[model samples]
Every structure is written in structure tokens, then in C-alpha cells.
Target: MIRGDLHELNRISWNAATVRHNSHKQDQAGFLRSGGSTLFPEEIELLGEIRGKEVLHLLCNSGQDTLSIAKLGAKVTGVDISDEAIDFARKLSSDSGIVGSFERSDVYPWLEAAIAAGRQFDVVFCSYGALCWLSDLAHWMRDVAAVLKPGGRFVCMEFHPVAMIFDEEGVPKYDYQMPEPLHWDTGISDYVGDSGGALAVSGAENVSEPFVNPNPCAEFPYSVSGIIGAVLDAGLELRIFREHLFSNGWKPYRRMAELPGRRWTMPEGMPKIPLMYGLVAVKS
Candidate 1:
């Protein structure tokens, strides 16, 4: 059960992420990596070429992926709670001459308005660390259903909740460091920095801005079943769901044997585990 105090903490988390997006253009760019089969690109491609399609992006951070879609000839509107990220996305859009719309609002409110107006789109897209921040999964799914046209697609590529269970040592465990989930909390017992625990990217010195969260919300573990349940509950028919251990996008899991593109496999005796999932569903 979500405690009442969490509302304040959630706001702080959004504010901190906004601060980071505004200050860390370079860092964000690096994360995007532009060009190649990163998570965003790979996920987008999995949805098939989006050329000339209309896409609505929920929790679109900094609009990098949104803009990328727009470049592919899809009319895209990216939404997020971070005013700073929206501002930067707008600037990036203008600089690149990509026709993309951006909305600075909480997903719930924006989705409510869209539903009330009976607005819909061809594709609803969300990705990367997006789903966990949401407080209500059912409502989020409802919003996706509300905004989708008949036969429209809903696509998401998120860090697997299984990943959230791992520690810096790569062991699986849970018990957040604080009472409630903090903004940066990965649902793990400890902090793992940006790139696992090995690389440290914190504050302005290490990143664009210091990531600070006064209140961290809880991260409910999402297994494949959990995710599929949300999509089905949202009134979508499951089309394709792909779980993989290797993705050129994240780069960290590149060396796994089960993954494509690399001749290397997991260490000779390493345990085989799933790190993430990519899913696509259709509104019927």
C-alpha cells in the first residue's frame, strides 16, 4: 500500500530528474548514443518502421526517442512531468528541425484530458525507467487504451524489474535503503550508480545535474506476467513480447552468449538470467 507521505517524495523525484535533464545535455546525449541498436532504437524497430505513423510517447524523457521517431516521418508528441526536459526537447527539436510536439504535464492529468476528449493515436510509446515511476499501473494502462485508436499499437521497452532485484555485486535481493522508495531507488538494497556499481555518475560533477529525491516511491517488481497483465487489463491484445539477455542498446549485457551480434557468450560457468523485456500490444 502506498503511504500518503509518498506524494511529496514523488514530486521531489520528478523535480530532481528535471534538474538533471536541464543540466546534463551531454550526459543525456551520451545515454542516447545516437545511431545504432541501443534499447530505444531496438525497441522502436521492433514496432516495425514507424514511417508516417502517429505516435504518442508517455514519460518521454528529454524527447530523444520521440524526436528520433519524428525524424522517421512519424508525427510524435512527447509528454513528461519534467518541465526542464520538455524545454530541452523543444530546443533539440527546433535545432534539428524535427516536427515534434511536447507536453509538460503529469501523465495522469494529460491522459485524463485525452480520454475525456476521446483523443487517440496510432501508436502509444514508452520506454526506459518509465513504468516504475508511475503510482498506478491499471490507470496507466487505461490511459494507453484511452488514447489508442482501434487496432492502434502500444509499445514499451523497460528495464526488467528482475534487474531491480540485483545488487552491485549482481546478487538478487530487495529491501530499499529507506522507508519508502526514493526517486533514485532501484528497489534494491543499495545504490548501483548509473552503469552498474562500477561506474559512478552522480551530481553535476559526474552528470549534468545532481539527482536528488526527498521521497522515493516504491517499485513493485514486474515479472513478464505482471507486465502482460497490465497490457491485457488496459484492453490490449498481446501481439509480441520479447525477453532477451542481450541488447546492443544497453551495452552492459553485450557479451552474453544468448544475445545477438557478439561471438562471446556468458562466462563459461555463469548463471543464465533475464535482464529485460520488450513488449508490444495492440488495442483491439
Candidate 2:
């Protein structure tokens, strides 16, 4: 009951966050239409050869990255819990002329159904802020392995667990080994820093007022060891693991600076810490 309630609250919060995130986002269709991709280089490199592969994207918020994969000639399906995100993803896919599918379902049930249905994919990709929202990686990784074809690969690029220990001011906040859900009262809002409400691209009205969503959010934290153990326990062979100094894209801290290729990193004179981690594991 507690887990279900947590998912419900987060689904509602993300539904609210998606609207604001979309508004700050500029020319999603136009950007893709012009051969631009939202995927960072790390994902591209980790994905290896995705062309013509069947790919499943878990918790694909708004299908932005999933569509980017579709644009690369992969047959991609994105699954998310937020109906608003899936709705917008379909619209974006159509508007950008990219062929892909998006489904609105909780990832656990969707994965179970996919496994029971014998639906398997050549690749399972989840990236950036993906792992924190999950209450447990053990169940998640087990189902993920079940949904992958034999010899299929799982590519993950997520914000490093250590990054969660710090506040925006470079001060330590949360513990890195938290194994339970953390309830947050502050409403999820635009992380893109768009205070001036504006919609980029065609066919949307630009509003100048800032949007507000009072919905609280909940997230779970898994230690680095916990994440690695789950994947290994799923019987997948861990092939590669890397930690990066720069973020995949989002600037979570005010003290950080953006570098080329849209990545962000801590400023000089600060200790260089791992902001993100990536891994590639293959079902054996």
C-alpha cells in the first residue's frame, strides 16, 4: 500500500513537472526535424550499435530520448507512468515525423506484462535521473533482465549515487546509502530554469507567467553497491563501468558550469567529483 501510494504521488508530480519541463523545452520537433538528437555522447557511445535493434526505454519521461533513438533507425518503445508525458510524446513523434511508440504504464507492471507476453528487446536503455525514483533496484533489474533477449545488452547512464550526497551549494546533505523512500514536500517544478513561461517551437502559445505545481514528491535512493549487486544478481555479466566528472545534461547545482555538447560540471577550485556513471551489461 505504501509503495502504491508513493508511485501514485510521483505519477501526479511528474505529470505536473512534465508540463513545465515541456514549456521550457524549445523546438523539440524542430530540433529533431533538423537531424538534432537529445542524447548525450555518453549514451550514444554506451548504446554501441542501436540501428535496427529493438529497444525498450524504461521510465522514458516524455519520450524525448526514446524518440532520439527512433530517429537513429532503432525500433523503440518508451514506457512511462505519466499519461501527460506519453500523450505529449506521441504528439512529438508525429509532429517530428519520427516513428516510435509510447505507453503509459507503471514500469513494474509493464515489464511483467512484457515478460509474460514473451516480448523481448535487443537493448534496454535507461539514463540520467532514472534510478533514484525506484524504490528498489533488485525487483527492477530482475524484471529488466527478463524482458531482454538472450545476449541482449542493458545500457545505463545515470547520475552517480555520490552526487546525491551534496546540496546545490556543494555542501553535503543526504546520506549516500539511504535504502528507503524519502518524502519531499516541495513541489516538483521546472528544472530547465525557465522562470518565464514560454513554449518553444510552433503551434503553442507562449505564456509569461511562471507555472506552479504544489504536488509533493517521493524518491528512493540506492547505493552504488546496491545497484551493481542487483544487476549482477539478475545474471547479467557486467562488461563496463565508468564514472564521469560531468553531468549528462541537467544542471542541478548553481555552482556548476555548462561545457560544450550541453554537459555540465563543477567549477574550478572545487573538488572534481563524479557527477554521473555509465555501465553496459549483457544478459549471459
Candidate 3:
């Protein structure tokens, strides 16, 4: 609600970022074609017994992880704001021979439509860097509650807000509570494929030295407890709130070391802090 032209500008920004980000993932289509999964270990463990469940993945950019969930035997539908992202998702689904349903819409209105249509899911899942785009966490949580059936669960794996408080030089300039929304004109980073060893795209390709955006985007950072409170106030019972030190795909700092499976963590002698988290809440 806070960002004016929320639908148009945000969609444009992500549509631009989606193409730029995926270009760095050399042969990503090849990876998926060989039955690759973009899921991290924490996600797999936390989402236990999802086979045959009706899973709704929100903010599911490009459907790499969405198709990964479908590979888990769940009937998964992915919802995203960017038309380019959803187009690539459907294309990837066909190219990779993975079946999934994709929708393009701003999450706020989409959730309302889902609720109005009486569409409810067994599990609502979203992950890393997903929540920051939303301006209203409380309303988002309320709508999340509306679209989940009784006994259904909401599962999220996200970059911890504690870790996000620090600036580029390790200064904690941001707030622990919800900070003022940040507007960025420079666009998103190629964070996913930046960790090195990205294979080359066989077809014609051009890499931008630094991908810039014509459209601006906004981000709203929330605290750990703020997220918990949002879920609780939405009438969902907090089942688990566990924090972790490693990050999936996106490295937070320069000094971080890479772990197995594309995960990154703080090197030895650095102060241990939660970089990411896994949360599960059930609709009671």
C-alpha cells in the first residue's frame, strides 16, 4: 500500500530483474532438464511429508523451486508478480518436462481472489528474499490465513532480518523493528549465480557488467519477532521458528565461506549470527 503504483512499478522492476538474474545462471535450463532441484536441504527437511499435498508457493519467482516442489510429488501451483518470470516458468516447465501451474499477479490482489474463490491449499510455502517486497505484513498474514485450510501449514525460509540490518561495511544501520521502506533504482543483483563456477549458456548471451533497472522497487524489512507476531495475530499457531547460520545461493557478506550444496556461511573467527531462518505455522 505504501509504494505508489505498487502493481505496475514492482512488476516492471521484477520483470527486468528476472531476465537479468537468470542470464547469469549459465545453462540453467540444462540443470533443470537433468532433473535438478533448486531447493536447499533446510527446505526439504522442514517441508516433510508434502507428497500428494496441495501446495501453494507465493512469490515463486521463475518456478525453479516451484518445479522442484512438484518433483517432490506434490501438486504445486506457483504465483508471482512478474509476467516475464511466469512466462519463463511455463517455458521451463515445458522444456524440463515438469508439470506445474503458474499465475502472474500481484500477491495482495491474487490472495484476495483466491480467498473469494474458496481456493485453499494444504501448505503455503515461500522462501528467501520473498517477504521484503510486501509493505503490509499484517494484512499479508491475514490473507495467508484466509487461503489456508484448517490444519494447513505456512512454511517460510527467509533471510533473517537480523542479518539484513547490517550495511555493506558491517554496520547495523537498519532497525530491528520494521524499518522504513527502501526504494532502489539500481535493481536486483545476480546474487544466485554470482558465487562462481556458473556454467556458460550455449546460446547467444550477453552479460551486463552491472545490471541496472529502468523501474524502481521498494523493500520493507521486518524483525524476527515482528514476523512471528504477524503469523500469530493472523490466527496461525507458530509451530516452529528455527534460525540458521548459512544462506542458500545468495551470499550476504564478502567474508562468508561456501558450504556444500551452494550454501554460504560465516568463516571461522567471525561472530556467529543467524543469517536465515525456517518458520512453520499452522492454521488452528
Candidate 4:
């Protein structure tokens, strides 16, 4: 499929997921409503102080993290391709009395526009399951750099590519080095609450039912070098690259052991694996 077609399919699938995520009792919206941040401690430390700083969040689904950063006194703008997600994010921000701007646009195009408008930010932040959605990391990173001021920071925390190759049963299924986009025709499911179950997407609002998707969605996988190399190629200086043993959520594994700080890890005796990774780069 063409890039536009692929993006449309992904957008629809994400919109469906967003509807469920916005209402899920344990999703980011819920956590943020309870005065919790979806950001990890490592992220907070890496970002440092943001008081009066400008932050641009890419693929910011539902604005939970965007608003959380706004709480830190940052002037934040969130961009997402999913219109439903952006709408939900705006409503959540207003309801929570948090100041943030939400825009419905794909990341690359949005970054391009920001660059043309001479809009630059102190930080460009993206996290957890975000990079896999992009088809071209090198080009994406260039745009990321384009929207950042000189010496601006780019912080990315995402599921480890190594972890993504494994199936729910801890069995290796996919390639560790995937060079092409992977497509799935099965119905899309909410990654958070009620994991593994498909949700329907229709014209109705406030959908609380599950439905099967009739179209396929696509995702591109990149290795560690592919990720970090792109950042370097974009003229961003690598500052920190760290891997975590725990995941932000337990959606990856069929069974997991709960850990401190609401994190989850592979059950004991399972060889310790990198479940997530964080990268902090500075544009120079």
C-alpha cells in the first residue's frame, strides 16, 4: 500500500483505540485525572526543568502526557494524526483546567509546518510505542531536528525493538531486524485496559463496544542502531541511551510480575530482557 493509504489505515485504527483509551478507567487519562503523570521518573530527570519552556509532543495521543508536562509550567503543544484522539485530548485538557494546545496532524507534516513557520521549541518529546508508527526514521528525525532550536533536547522513550520481536508467549516470532513495514489485518484492540480485545469503530460517539476491523494496519520496526543512528544523522548529539527492564504497561506479555512504581517485568527466572529504552539527544 502507498504511504498515504497506510497512514489512513493506521489513523483509523488509532482513532478506534483512542475512543477506548479515553474512557478506560486505568488508562493515561484516568491516571492524569488522578494527578499522576504518565511520564517515567527517568524522563522527568532527563527533561530537567521546563518552567516556561516550550515543548512539542509528537503523536501525543489523548493529551495525557502533554497536560502532565504542562503541569510542570511548560507551554506545550500536542500533535496527533487521529482527529478523535485530538478532540478527546482537548476536552481532557479543558476539563482538567490544564493549558495545552492540541492539533490533529501527522507528525512529519506537522513538523514540516512548524519548521516553515519558524516555530522552534526547547524540547521535542515522544514516548512509548511512538517511533514504530513511523515508516522512515531518518527523515522523521530530520524533521524533529528542524522543529527544535539549536541545543534543544529530543527525548524518546519507547518499547525496545528487541522486545517487540517476541510474541506474547515469550517466543521469538518476528525478525530482530525488520527492514520493511509489517501489516496486520486483524481487528485492532485497545493496548491498555481490556488488553487483547478488539474494538469497533463507527459513526457513533462514546462507543463502549468492541468491533472487528475489516482493514489492515501497518507498523515499521527499527533496531537500536537504526533508532540512534537516525538521531545522529539528523545532527542531534546523543546524550543518553538507557534501557529499562520494566515496561510502562503490561500489554506485551501474556503474564508478568508486578513491580514497584506500577511497572511490570517478566516473571522471575525469565532472563532479564530490555523491555523499553530511552534516548536523550540534543540538536547542535
Candidate 2, residue 266: how far the Cα is off, in Å: 1.3
Writing each residue's lDDT as its tens digit, candidate 3 over 81-187 gives: 89999999999888888889999988888999999999999999999999998878899999999999999999999999989877755567876765477777765
Better of 1 and 3 by TM-score: 3
Q: In angstroms, give how far residue 34 of model 4 lies from its true place.
A: 6.1
Q: What TM-score, computed on C-alpha atoms, does each candidate reach?
A: 0.75, 0.93, 0.91, 0.90
Name every residue pair that clashes in candidate 3.
Answer: none
**How many pairs of residues collide in each model?**
9, 0, 0, 2
C-alpha RMSD for every candidate? 5.6, 2.9, 2.7, 4.4
In order, the Cα lDDT scores of the candidates are: 0.63, 0.83, 0.82, 0.79
**Model 3 quality (TM-score):** 0.91
- In model 4, the clashing pairs are 199-211, 200-211
Q: Which wins on lDDT, candidate 1 or candidate 2?
A: 2
Task: Arrange candidates, best TM-score first.
Answer: 2, 3, 4, 1
Candidate achieving the largest lDDT: 2
Clash-forming residue pairs, model 1: 9-215, 24-208, 38-249, 39-249, 181-216, 181-217, 182-216, 203-210, 257-265
